[model samples]
Target: MGVVNVTPDSFSDGGRWFEPEAAVEHGLRLLAEGADLLDVGGESTRPGAHRVSPDEERRRVLPVVADLVAAGAVVSVDTTRAAVAAEAVEAGAHVVNDVSGGLADPEMYRTVARTGAVYVAMHWRGPSDVMDGLARYDDVVAQVRDELAARVAEALGAGVAPEQLVLDPGLGFAKQGADNWPLLAHLDALTGLGRPVLVGASRKRFLGHLLADRDGVPAPPEGRDRATAAVSALAAAAGAWCVRVHDVPGSADAVRVAAAWRAARDVTTHGETSGAHHA
Candidate 1:
C-alpha cells in the first residue's frame, strides 16, 4: 500500500497532494514505483490533529479516488466516516482503511457490508485530538490484540463477512515511542488473531526518534524512509499481510528481499531438523 494524504496538515507530505489532480498524479507515480494498492486519506490522523467534517473529508477524497480508479489503480480510502467510505466505494474505492476501526462511526461496518469493500480496522482508542492520553496499557501488544479482537467482533456483529475484514495495530496513533517497539518486535501476536495485519509505520515520529541525531534531534520525515523500509522488511518477514508506506519503491524492494531471506532460512532450518531426526 502507498499512502497519499489529501489533507493539508498530515504529519508528512500532506498539502503536497491535497489537490485532486496532484493526488491522482501522485497515485499513478506510486503505481509505477510498485505500489500494489493506493491508500488516499482526507484527514491528517497525526497526533493532536483535529477532526475534519465528514463533508469536507468526502470532498477532498472522492474526486481523487475516482480519478485514480479511472487511471486503473486499486484504491483504499483512508477514513473513519461511513458516509465518506460509502461515497468513495460508490466512486470506485476497493477498500476502506478506517483508523478508528468501527468505533468512530456507528454505521461503518454496515456501510462496508453494504458496499462489499474490504475493511481495515485499525486499533484505536479515540480520535487524534486526544489519543495520546489514551495510550495507557498493561501490555501494549497483547492489549492491542485483544482490543482488535473486539473490533473484529463488532464488525462481525454488524454483518460483515469474516474474509472482508483486516486488522491494523495503529503503530503511532496512540502509542508513545516505547510502546511501538514491542508491538513491532512481536507482530506475530497480532497476526495470530486469524486476521491479516496491515502495518502503517511510514515516516512516523517513532522512527525519527529511533534514528535521533547526536544532538538528540529526531531524524526528519523525508530522512526516515530507509528506516521505514527496514520496518517493512521485518514486518513482512513476520507475516504482515501488507505494509502501508510512503516510499513504495523502498518497501517494495525490502519485502521482496525479506521474503527471499525467509524462504532460504526455512529451507536451511528444515534440512537441519530432518538430518538431526534421522541421526
Candidate 2:
C-alpha cells in the first residue's frame, strides 16, 4: 500500500499532494512504482495534530478518491469519520482505513458494514492531539493485540463481516518510540488474531529515532525510507498482509524479495522433509 496524504500538515510530505490533481498524480506515480493500493488521508494524524472539520475533510478527499478510482487504482480512504468513509466508498473507494478503529465515531462500523467495503481497524488509543499521553502499555505487543482483538469484536458486533476486516497496529498514533519496536518484533501476535494485518511503519518517528545521528538528533521523515523498507521486508516475511509506505518503489522491491526468500525457504523445508522420509 502507498500513502497519499491530502492534508497540509501530514508529518511526511505535507502539502506536497494537498491539491486533488497533485494527489491523483502522486497516487498514479506510486501505482506505477508498484503500490498495490493507495491510502488517501485528508486529516493529519501526526502527533499533536488537530482535527479537521468533516466538510473540509470530505472536500479535500472525495475528488482525489474519485479521480484515483477512475484511473483504476484500488483506493482506501484513510479516515475516522463514518460520513467520510461512506461517501468515499460511494465515490469508489474499495477500503475504509480508519486509524481510530471504531472508537472515533459511533456510526463507523455500521457505515462500513452497510457499504460492504474492506475495513482497516487500526489499534488506536485516542485522537492525535492527546494520543502521546496514552502510550502507557504494560506489554505493548500483547496489549496492542488484545486491543485490536477488541476492535475486531466491536466491528463484528456492529454487523461487519469478519472477512471484510483488516487489522493495523497503530504505530505512531499513541505509541512511544520504544513501543513500536515490540509491536514490529511480535507481529505474529497481531496476525494470530485470524485477521489480515496491515503494517504502516513507513517513515515514522520510531524509525527516525532508531537511525538517529551521533548527536542523537532523529533522522528526518524522508531519511527514514530505507529503514522503512527494511521493516517492510521483515513485516512481509512475518506474514503481514500489506505494508503502508511513503516510498513505494523501495518497499515494493523489499516485499518482493521477502516473498521470494520465503518461497525458497519453504522449498528447502519441503526437500528436507522428503529426504528424511526417503532415508
Give all candidates' CA lDDT scores: 0.93, 0.95
Residue pairs with backbone atoms closer than 3 Å in model 2 (clashes): none
* RMSD, every candidate, angstroms: 1.7, 1.7
Per-residue CA lDDT of candidate 1, range 87-108, in tens? 9999999999999999998999
**Best model per lDDT:** 2
Q: After superposition, how far is residue 188 of candidate 1 from its true place, in Å?
A: 1.2
Best by TM-score: 2
Candidate 2 regions with alpha-carbon error over 4 angstroms: 270-279
lDDT of 2 by residue, 1-279 (tens): 999999998899968999999999999999999999999999999999999999999999999999999999999999999999999999999999999999999999999999999999999999999999999988998889999999999889999999999999999879999999889999999989999999999999999999999999999999999999999999999999999999999999999999999998877877798999999
Record all residue pairs in model 1 with backbone atoms less than 3 Å apart, i.e. clashing: none
RMSD in angstroms between candidate 1 and the native structure over all alpha carbons: 1.7
Candidate 1 TM-score versus the reference: 0.96
